[model samples]
Target: MPTCPSPRAPNGSSSAQLPVREKELTRQYDLLASARRGLPMVRVDRDYIFEGPSGKYRLVDLFEDRLQLIVYHFMFDPAWEKGCPACTRYVDALRDLSMLTRRNTAFALISRAPFPKLETYQKERRWDRLWGSSFGSDFNYDFRAALDEKIPTVH
Candidate 1:
């Protein structure tokens, strides 16, 4: 992760000289972050299976013994030949995320597309991040990442 730059005044002054509005906005942003951290957590009871390069794996396996797992629900519909352009761009913009491992967190990309397609795309893009396929599983629908009229949501 990149470090946040210290706030600077328009006149090349210190952050202590920042305008009232900027300070207020920073305070509001901090409060919102605190609220998000305080939100209640839900336990996942369902066992979701995913396909990867090695083989099929359960949802808990994606954690890789890390304290937390961060999954990026990349939008790649089964019928589509390629991933979403926006999602591709976002992945392209990502920097080295190895820093996350040091924080006891693991990250992976989960898509509804078949594993073969995801593997080919990952190789073509030269991305070494862990990618998994949720095809034939309710993982995406249960997480509200994939939408389909035929599949009933698990509200």
Candidate 2:
């Protein structure tokens, strides 16, 4: 979540600088320093293993001559072919991700669809990049991405 400042200021300067309190400034500075000292991570893993149509692979496999793996999950299940429209919407927006590749990081897309299904989708989208498919690998369930807390799903 983020703050939404009023479009117009009381004095109407046409723009307003976000106000940061002393405590907030201090906290932000500390966070910045910590980030400079070491990269921030949402979750770190060194020993995760997954399977796919090709074979078994480790988290490091996604690194591919790099040191970081940025992965996005796209829904591509054949059973749900013409897959979940909502998920498709998300995938459709991820067209250009070259900036992530400019650095020493590898970006991959993981999906439940088989290689063939993924190939078809990629062809339709005219996507040139390779996106990893982990169908039957159960990686989604293992990562808790396929589980629905609201309902008992086969995930």
Specify the highest-lDDT model's number: 1
Using alpha carbons, what is the TM-score of model 2? 0.55
State the lDDT of candidate 2 residue by residue for 61-132, as single tens digits. 788888667777666664655556676677777767677778778877777776677767777876665466
How do the predictions measure up, each by TM-score? 0.73, 0.55
Model 1 per-residue lDDT at 29 = 90
**Mind sharing the TM-score for model 1?**
0.73
Clashes of each: 0, 0
Q: What lDDT score goes with residue 133 in model 2?
A: 68
Clashing pairs in 1: none
Alpha-carbon lDDT of model 2? 0.65
For candidate 1, give the lDDT: 0.88
